[model samples]
Each structure stands twice: as structure tokens, then as C-alpha cells.
Target: MNTNPATIRKGRKFEQVLEGARDIFLRDGFEGANVDDIARTAGVSKATLYSYFPDKRLLFIEVFRQECDRQTLAALDQIDLGAPVAEVLRQAAGHMVASFVNEFNQAVFRICVAESDRFPELGAAFYRSGPRRLHDELAGFLAGVDGQGEVAIPDAALAADQFIELCKADLYLRHLLRIDDSFAPEEIARVIDGAVATFMARYGVRT
Candidate 1:
């Protein structure tokens, strides 16, 4: 990653376009968002926009992909390599829950779920870009911790998937459906805490 000024400026402009496109898509849905409106929102000419993204579909998918990547990266930052497996897993689960509660995540997740049928590419791109990476990173970490006999997971990938599912099941589906009920902080804490406890009961180090 070189730190050239021109590259930095272009990157910033591209990010601006993605932000604008995301806002438009959330407000108007994919079919209603126009490239010209995105360009105006980004304060760039349509020509400049094309120089970055060739079409609205690509731009829209990238916007959602970028949002997913941002959330994944934030969660990645919280992993503590030196911590015990159960502790690390608890932290990871908590981070996962907190990430979905963010406003940007709620909006982006809504768009991804709603447009998944019409824009399969967008959904595929999101899985490839975000959840796939998270799964890989989590599996890698679990392998390390398992090697230390801190956990009993025979297959880290399966364990990671299970962990994600258990942590996200109700939270994700409810949020996607716009369910009126909201999880209180205490409730969220309990959900994540219980998930981790159950995982440890199955996988934690035995005396």
C-alpha cells in the first residue's frame, strides 16, 4: 500500500461515492437510485463516477460490500490472540452482536436482504467479501486456540459457523424483518453471554 497523494485522493473520492450510493439505495431502493443522483451526492461529475465505477449495479454492490467489509474489519480488530479460547470467543460474539446494532449495519443489512432476490450478485459479493473473510479469520484463530487444548473443537470452520449462527440467529432475522421488539443492552449481554457459556460447556478445556 503506497502512500501517494494521487492514490489517496482517488481513494477518498471513491469512498465518497460509495457513501452517497449507500444513502441513495437505502432511501430509494436499488431500482430507484440513479447514477446522476449518486454523482451529485458525491459532488463529482458523472464522468468522474464512471472513471471509478462503470455502472450503477457495480457501484451499488460495492457500496454494500464496503459496508459489510467495514463491519467485519471492526470485529476483526477485537480478537485477542493471547486470550483463552472461551474468553476470545465471548469477545467475538459480543462484537458480532454490537456490530449489527449499529445504524449503518441495520440499513445495509436491510438493503442486502431486500434486494437479494433481484440482485443475487450483490448478495454473493457480500458473502464473498465479508462473512467469508470473517469465517476464515475465525477458523484460523480457533485452530490456534484448539492446538493449545483450550477448546475441543475438532473442526474450527464448523465451530465458527455454529458460533455465528447461535449468536446471530434471532438478532439478524428480527432486524431484517423490521420486528418492533428491540433487545435491551442487558438482554443482548445475556444472549451473547449464554451463547459463549454453552459453547464453552461443549468445547472448553477440561481439567
Candidate 2:
């Protein structure tokens, strides 16, 4: 389809605001960030910013959605569906755990928890954008794998949730609590391998 120049320009400006708002939110947090600074950082007028996003919360949600789509959900597209099921699970679990344990993601999760009482929708918005979306994507993958007879998953969605939780294990909790700031590569690998093995033990088809 052909593009309109004005629409293209508007889209570019919208992206600029998103980038600026994300930086400000990450640096100053949801309550601390202000529209004036976001506009200034974005090199756009306050009117322009408001025209695109009427409120700070909407802008924050957009930023969060972009981050979730880019960092969390996009990884699923990289998996080779033709590969061995165990290998695919390991790769997918690795991506999920790695995304969850990162500093940026942990901060986002903390923001959701800390603000949920005041802005109850914030938590729901985050869940829909991040965890729920990831779960759905993984569920779809598992269903496809099951259809191929690679795994015997009677309930693909439940199995997806279980596998992701197994991948998180205690490491994600430790990171969230600031009890541990980092994990070794070997530790991550071990976690992914164990998660895959556990899932297979429960769901793999018999010979």
C-alpha cells in the first residue's frame, strides 16, 4: 500500500515521543516523570505530544507495550519450528528467563507492583502487554508442536504457563527482590535445560 507523507511524518513524531517518554520513565519512573520533560526530550511541542497521547498514563502504556512487543514477544518469532521440540523449548525458555531477569524488565515489573494500588489498570495493562501476551504466544507454539505429535500436551495453554513458570523458578524472584542482581551463563543454561526436561517428562510422547 502507498503511504501518505503527512501520515509518515506523524508516525515519526509519535515514535520520537515514545523514545523520549521511555527514557524519562526509566530514569525518573512513572510518578516522577513529567510531560514537559518528555516533550522537551522528544523535540516536540507539548501540543504535539498531547495530540498523540492525551495523558502520561497512556504514553507510559504505549512505551511499555513497545518494550514488551520488542523484547519479550518478538523472541518467539526467532524459534525454528522444525527444530527438535526440546531444543525449541530450551531456546524459548532461555529467551523468556533472560528477558524477565534483565534490569529494565525488573524495573518495569516493580513499577507495575508499586503503582497497582493507585493505578489499578496499570497492572492489568502490563499483564496484557507482557506476561499474558507471552503466555499466549507460547501456548500457540506448544499447540502447533502438539499437532505435529512432538509433544503430548492435552492442554497447551496450561502447559505453556507451567513451562514458563518452571523456567522462572526462583531466579526471577531473587532478581525482583534485589537479592541477586545477576546470574551466571551456566546458571541460566541449567535453568532452561531443567525446565525443558521437566516439561518433556510431563508431556513428551512415549516411544
Candidate 3:
């Protein structure tokens, strides 16, 4: 919100408008979302909703970016950086895996792909708020760990990218392709554990 886009003023009711837009967009989606509903939900008049977002697509994109930020950046704060390398990796992987299988993300992915041609910003927004943010977070953490001699990652950025890709090994593609939706705890554990082991094997400092 205010963190980025300084031009877009955050009024006394800015968050209120966004909250309403989020509710309507999630419940009804881009095409189905109406300004009237968003305004009513936010308890603001139509003028207020229009004042914040001149177009519905803009509102939808903002909400999508907001959700992605919430999912990736906010959740990163909860991961205990002081934990052992393996445990820290597991914690990060666990959150990543959950997001991969989450309904909101799945829906966002579907909508982005479906409407990408018409609303090209959807892809860019997703990348910026989701994968890009996550990558930076992981890369920063790995670099610190490497500096501390806890890991042997010569290329922290590359290792971060690889770790994220490893977590997407099976379930991600399947779920995105609509092959499977069920997220079994055992399956998730397997993915998380394998990602951690593989990363550690490559980067873990030999004791």
C-alpha cells in the first residue's frame, strides 16, 4: 500500500476500500466483481470506491498483490532465523509448500493464466509480490548463513532459486495442472524433507 506506490494516496478510508474490494474480488472474482458490491461491503459509497480505484481491474490487481505480499513476506517474519540450518530450511519449505497448495493461490494462479492476455499486469503482479519477494528473502537468509560458515553456498542466489524449485518438484505442477487438489500431510512432509536434505547435501557445512 503506502510502502509502494506513493502516488496512490492512502486516505483515512484507504484500507477500508481495499478490504471491501478484497471481499468482493475473492467472492465474485474479477469479471463478476461489481463496484457497487465492493462499496457496500466496505461500507463506503460508490464514489469512494471509484475514488480509490478508477477501474475494477486495478482494484483486482491491487488485491492480488496484497494477498501475495501477505502470503510470502508476512509469513517470512514468523520463520525462526535462529533455528538450525536444516530446521530453518524446513520451516521455509513448509510455508512455501502450504502456499503452493492454498486455495487462494490456486485461484489467483488460475485467474492470472486465464485473463493474462487481457489483463497482462496479472502475471507481473504475481511475480513481483510472490516468487520475487520469496526469492529475495531466501537469498538474503542463505547469504547470511553462508557468511557465518554454517553453509557452503558459494552462490546464495542460485541456491535460493534451486531450493524454491526443489520444493515445487511434484505437487506444484500437478496441482497447477488440476491433476490433484488434495494435500496430504505425509506428502507435504516428504516434499519438505526432501528439499531440505537435497539443499543441505549441496550446501551444508561438513562438521
TM-score, one value per model? 0.85, 0.89, 0.86
Clash totals for all candidate models: 0, 0, 0
Q: Can you write out model 1's per-residue Cα lDDT over 1-207, one digit (the tens) per residue?
A: 222223322455888787778778877777788888888988888888877776566776677667767777776676776777777888888887776566666765566777889777667766776678778988888877775776877999998888877788567667656783478778788878888988888778888
lDDT of 1 at 20: 78
Per-residue alpha-carbon lDDT of model 2 for 98-186, expressed as tens digits? Answer: 88898877787888888999887788888999889988988998888885666888899999899989989878999989999999998
**Regions of model 3 farther than 4 Å from truth:** 1-7
Full candidate order by lDDT, most accurate first: 2, 3, 1
Candidate 1 vs 3: which has more lDDT:
3
Top candidate on lDDT is 2
TM-score (C-alpha, index-matched) for candidate 1: 0.85
Could you tell me the TM-score of candidate 3? Answer: 0.86
**Can you give the lDDT of residue 85 in candidate 1?**
75
Residue runs of model 1 more than 4 Å from their true location after superposition: 1-12
**lDDT for each residue of candidate 3 in 85-105, tens digit (9 for 90 to 100):** 889999999999988877778
Assess the local accuracy of residue 164 in candidate 1 as a C-alpha lDDT between 0 and 100.
Answer: 76
